[model samples]
Target: MNLKSAWSRRSFLSSLGVASGSLLTSATAKAEGMFGKKPKAETKRLVDGNPIVPITSGLGSTGDIYAELGVKPLINIVGTVTVIGGSVMKPEVMELIRRGNEHFVLIDELEVAAGKFIARLCKSPAGYTGLVTGGAAAAMVVGYAAMMTEDLEERIKLCPDVATFPRNEVIIQKAHRYAFDHQIRQTGAKLVEVVTREEMIAAINPKTVAIHFTNIQSDRGQVSGPETVAIAKAHGIYTFNDASADVPPVSRLWEYPAVGFDMVTFSGGKDIQGPQASGILIGKEELIHWALLNMSPQEDRIGRCCKVGKETIFGLLKALEIFVNQDYDETLRMYDARAKLISDAIAKFGVTARPREFNPNALGNVTPRYSWQIDPTKLKITGQDVMQGLADTKPVGIGSFGAGAGGMRGRDPEAEARMKAHPELAQQRRRGNGPGRDPNTFGFAVWQLKDGEDQIIADRLVEIFSAAPKA
Candidate 1:
């Protein structure tokens, strides 16, 4: 079936399930009354129609658990971001996760089976397979550990202390170094920084385990992917590509490994809409085997903390299956429709909302975005003001307006202190108030918004503009 049909069916089934649960409750109450016993008091439920599993009581529910705790849930306009919670799981994926919880199985056998399934689905190069990880970062720790330790139990136990190991160095481009490198560093391997192809070649020595390529920054570095692969191949060194956020062309899932990166990692939670804590690592069979040995269901290893549950593995597999087969053109159209709805609603307020064309080669979280240009002459409020206004909306806050303006709502004194201590961090705030950071403009992608959220956003925008004074 087409993606549109599949999505419609999934939504219908989800609604049917909720309706069935409600009907069951009503019938039970009626039966109790018919038997002449007083019907039990109706218990309040968490908003969003899903009762918290294991069902706790005494929680008043005008909203979801977030609201119960005085935190506002948001209409996510941001692409998959871990801070606000990654993309929602497809109904089928959630069903698989729930099903997986019903029976216990040997995690080792499950991982191997899942790996074979992933390898076949993604079309990884021969001698390569897949492994579910805690997250993309966990994949790095285990992938690097696999290269450094191989299959030796003695070496595995002594990981992160590879001071005496023959291969403890990872080569990376100077420009490619980012926050996620901490994962590589966690394995106790020293990162050898190289700026040029010649420098990379010269830096490789007896200790070099692999060349770490940051996929999104492939163009920024002097050495290209093919060149890096060639260099690694020539030297008999391993290569790993951190392509976590790179998908949507879905073909990239196998393409990178096909290009000779011995290991490649992707965030299952991001575009795949799998469990938030899950990731996929596909690479050489030998390396993946070593990675698995170092991770969960094993003891006293460097990756012991990075455990992947059976449910998460199943959910990620289902998500991957859906993601690969789903239609993208239809998805884009749905996003466009959502943007147009919000745009039309606020047009009278002099805000022009135009959709940005999707770039096929966008580095990560690829999605079409909508840019809202506020006509200063028609509306006194700036785009940042509108963002904040949306964030302050009642019932649910519409968010993902780039950090301080709205994305992070609560006060964070610790973060403020860190910013104060590290003045350069001020420059790191996303899309700061400078060029292209027009005060009269703000934008976000609509693909992440749930059903009917676009209308809520439209109604909220109307409320915000209605309250703003005319210019």
Candidate 2:
């Protein structure tokens, strides 16, 4: 049904059901933090830091979903990552998505309208446009196809079969060859790897259609952004960058394309807290025009297989708006406060936790996290044991609570390369014998935690340590 009809039905239901005022009040109460209200005697904390609070009393409505499903919900102290279901959507984004699902509109028409709005906010240049896709990987597929050909018939009909096309090669840095590059290759474009700036310059040829750059790999590559864009522009080749997680320095939303890349894709779900299946592709309008020609709701196109739903498109748009207007400083302060609370909970045990930069590489979650330094001699339990204990909890608490580089299970080649580039981080990772030696550290992040949940996490850690045998 159309949006108008849906709204009419909702209005009719509102009149028959409990009043809208009561519904609004219920929602407001659910949104408010339980701990934000003044504490009663039962909830009050004593000088010893332990509180006699009940878990179910002041908790919000989130428990309802897991409780009904019979799935225990764990406290996520890890930053936003896809494995943990990305970031939790804000109520505003979720509401738009719910409303969007009620509407019936031509998908292409929605793209045009939403694209215009996104383009305006992105400050896209004249001849530049913006479009949403089913996450960053899909954007790469669509964006690569757009730059490869302008023939509407070929794009609409038998596109991914680009053997007839001369633009068959995509140039990328060897260091930047991430798993996401598979998205670019899905369009039948061969990825030509290059190491040094000279190699990259040499790698470009008549077969080269576009150069792919990764913002996270920027620190690792020898070629600079200006150089990559300039070389691509000189040869009249397009540049597409996968900046899926390089946000907050939210200025990055526009900065990459504004500089020179022909197109750039950002994940809607990662830091933006948009729909998990949504993403934005912002770049040259001519290219975007071709991209839309190859996009969904269009039958005869290579991108027809990758369809983005209406709810995701509108939801991402609202999420982008909220992300753009968010008070970044205030958000950072909240994250720091969460980290501090976790740190303070374990202070008496001689384990010092503080907000510090955790991962500073392309593959890592580059953000400040609560890094805990443990004197293993003081506690019989090792950091890995602590990690295993947390993992064993009823509703498992997932965090960086292990004894490796950045608390990762095994060695990561990308982290190793990044460590080689920075001598100090390499030395820091080495506890004694060599680089792979287990470091006596564990960490947690608060960027993904919802309100009133930090205390739960802190209490969990305390419980784990309290049960540990004293050295």
Candidate 3:
């Protein structure tokens, strides 16, 4: 409606005081979805003069000024990782975070209640856990304490010099100890590395706290998942699993706790869609309770450093909810289709662009990693050059910089099963040249792309590959 019509309606409502729920609902529905154009208010920004902009807003963020000027961001052909600001959270997560912003609640009580619900979801033994440090690395540290401290007072008295804390040793397979936030050491616990099952078993003693398991690291690790946990439990020690970015089965959240990984640390920013700084530590009820009691702001609280805000909590919860209710089988299929599109587009070049399914053994992304191979010799440009071109193109930023290193050569993974099925592809991939010899592989992740964005990017990639001169 124009100004006059809007004014007339406002005047009528003022006298009537008819603030009907139906009217609010209908108006919001229309404004949010049914309306032909999105509301300018969708883009909120902070005011320069004031820290919080409750009043005036500059025209810059509204996209209105930008639309008039013709500007937009490149499509993100990646998955939801913190570096990319995480996948634009699901709509519900944004709404929940907004609700949290508008309200207040007791932090202790909030954590307590949230823990109960989260634990139930994961079937964890802990009451619930919290991270103050803002990364899953902190989650591992705080979780390490949950099992070691033994009680509330001891939990409070954490971080004494090495001589002070009892059972200060944490055994990790020589290979499993990768670049985590060092949560285990955060407890001031010592790390003892063993190279074999014999070494691990021999390493476990009275001081042994727990065995750490890392799922994503590629190095040949001495400890296997089931074996690490089994060994720890048999010796009455705890098992902590680090499954960051390994969130495909979505069911894995609860699966870890159920399978007896005393504490499992997950990247909230990467997969669970929680705050980049927040990680979830769920397992053993007694341990979870201790972990919370040890969390930050409590006097001498060991975990006083790993705090999560109301917004992060709500957003994380929302992401998890989508993960829980999401049709995994269908989502996987969609990613499969996305990979196939690019693969099929250039398949005529005699290169195999196949969809890599999500299997635990695969080194690719948690979701299916669609990769396309190019005959490097036939495509005059190096894979890196093509990557640079795509990045420098009008719609740049397709995948990671690594994918540009000519297909398959730059750590792009092959599904273990697929590797077996396509033995020739593997041998060709390991030592193939461009086009005829080297099948240029492009691994595509679907989570990062907005709706229908894959088409534009995939098509653009096809064009670049088909057009570029072969090396």
Best by lDDT: 1
lDDT of 2 by residue, 1-471 (tens): 011112355455645453555566555665564647643223221121222222443332343545545654556666676665678899899877876776578998899888888888877766777899988888988889887867467644666788878788999998888989988888888999998988988888888898889877887988878889998898899998888988866777778788889998889888899988888999887888788878787777878877988889889999999999899778878988888887899888878874377443334355666678777778777665666566566744455323353365665769868887887786554432245535567665678888877877778779888888888
What would the C-alpha RMSD of candidate 3 be, to one decimal place?
Answer: 11.3
Candidate 3 residue-wise lDDT at 312 = 74
Structure candidate 1, residue pairs in collision: none
Angstrom error of the Cα, residue 10, model 2: value is: 12
What lDDT, from 0 to 1, does candidate 1 have?
A: 0.87
How are the candidates ranked when ordered by TM-score, highest leading?
A: 1, 2, 3
Report lDDT (Cα) of residue 426, candidate 3: 73
Candidate 1 lDDT over 298-333, as tens digits, reads 999999999999999999999999999989998888
The lowest-lDDT stretch of 10 consecutive residues in candidate 2 is: 44-53
